[model samples]
Target: MSTEPTASGHEAASPAVDPPAWLQRIKSNYCRVCGSPLKLLKPDGEREWRHVCGSCGYVDYHNPKLVVGCIVEHEGKILLCRRAIEPCRGLWTLPAGFMELNESTAAGAARETWEEANAAVKVLAPYAHWDIPVIGQAYILFRAALAPPYTFSSGSESLEVALFAPESIPFDQLAFSSVSITLRLYLEDLRAGTFRLHHGVIDKRPGSQPNDPGAFVVRDHMALELGGASATAAGPGVQEQ
Candidate 1:
């Protein structure tokens, strides 16, 4: 049997449920380091409250896991990969995966590019940080220059890899809203010779509510606004939406 992952990493479709508790909960659980019920404090200009470990003074913020990928350019074509596993199996997308612990985000992006497309890339500039709705996943995009023409790796998570021009991008086959929106903005910037990298959030979770507790939404975009000298060689620390 052909093993192909469905969209967004899972084979089955996810229900349009409420946003994740990870971001919605105003209070976090008791801290493991300190055997005490953590204190909740909503930081200024942010959504969810932060959990402060009273005994240890460990402030646990509601930060989502980050995954980074490269939008690689080679011979006037952009590299694309077909996800072999879920949440978006068989869909076309750029090479991307989660950020591993103890590694820099830039390194993680480069690694995912190599693993997914079998392409070596040099990170050029930062792209956008996207928060996938409902799924509670965050992605960081990077502008990269492909080392050469790439072939698909026979991995457990990819079917094939190919390249396409900007006008020929497969919108319907993209993995998620982030991928689609990033491509659109990138293409526009590429044509206009203006690189206006945006710092915002895109909520794709299900349900619609202002403060109904379960309604999906993204907030506190100041994290992404860290630009200029404040942005380190490691790039901005944009938590997933």
Candidate 2:
């Protein structure tokens, strides 16, 4: 789509940190493909350790999960849902969820919007792509508009749903940094009359040292030149769910 300056800014890399507990649990557990115990091994020319099955030779690739969402705007208000699940219960966030297999990212975004808000939206172009290595989730966000009628209800995953004006967004109580960042950029673009694709990384490694990097950093994709690194990198750990 549009290539305008983003209000949310870019994320930068910092000192490497420890993985999350959920990922550690998966690494210590047995293989899912087979009932065999997993062992750490450097496969072929790889630098880091990988979980390999002793009996079945299954290799567990710790990849970032794909999460899809939509920025559903009706009139001038944006839709937000109060999370009913753990990790961030009762917190407000955009309509988003883990992407299922056999579905396109756009379709998944639309599905999540409908599931979380019970609202129909016309899925538009991809808007923001966030690489959340600490949580092992790569978020693909789409820019969408509310379809006709603009009625909405809270789905099972949401405790409640409502539309909020840009100036009234609850930034302090957002469920995730990605959601906050996306909304900020969207609001800024709305004011500037331009919307651009945003790419950035968010690291949420727990117990990080103070002198270490902050929880969030956004890179200037327009100014910096990436040699050839994939936007989504394989982080140190993996999460089962």
Best of the candidates, TM-score = 2
Lowest summed-lDDT stretch of 10 residues in model 1? 227-236
203, model 2: CA deviation in Å? 2.6
Candidate 2, 8: how far from true, in Å?
Answer: 31
Which TM-score value belongs to model 1? 0.62
The 10 consecutive residues of candidate 2 with the worst lDDT sum are 231-240
* Residue-by-residue lDDT tens digits, candidate 2, 91-203: 89999999999999989999999999999988756778888766678999987788877799999999999999889998878887788788888776666555666787766
Global lDDT of each model? Answer: 0.67, 0.74
lDDT for 231 (candidate 2): 22
lDDT for 11 in candidate 1 is 40
1-241 per-residue lDDT for model 1 (tens digits): 2337776465444344543354445446788677777866654664435677878877776556897998887666788898888777778888888899988888999999888777788777677876654555678998777764444464456798887887898887887666777787777665654555555576644554212333434443423223232222222223333
* lDDT, model 1, position 22: 43
Q: With candidate 2 superimposed using the best TM-score fit, by how many Å does residue 102's alpha carbon deviate from the native?
A: 0.6
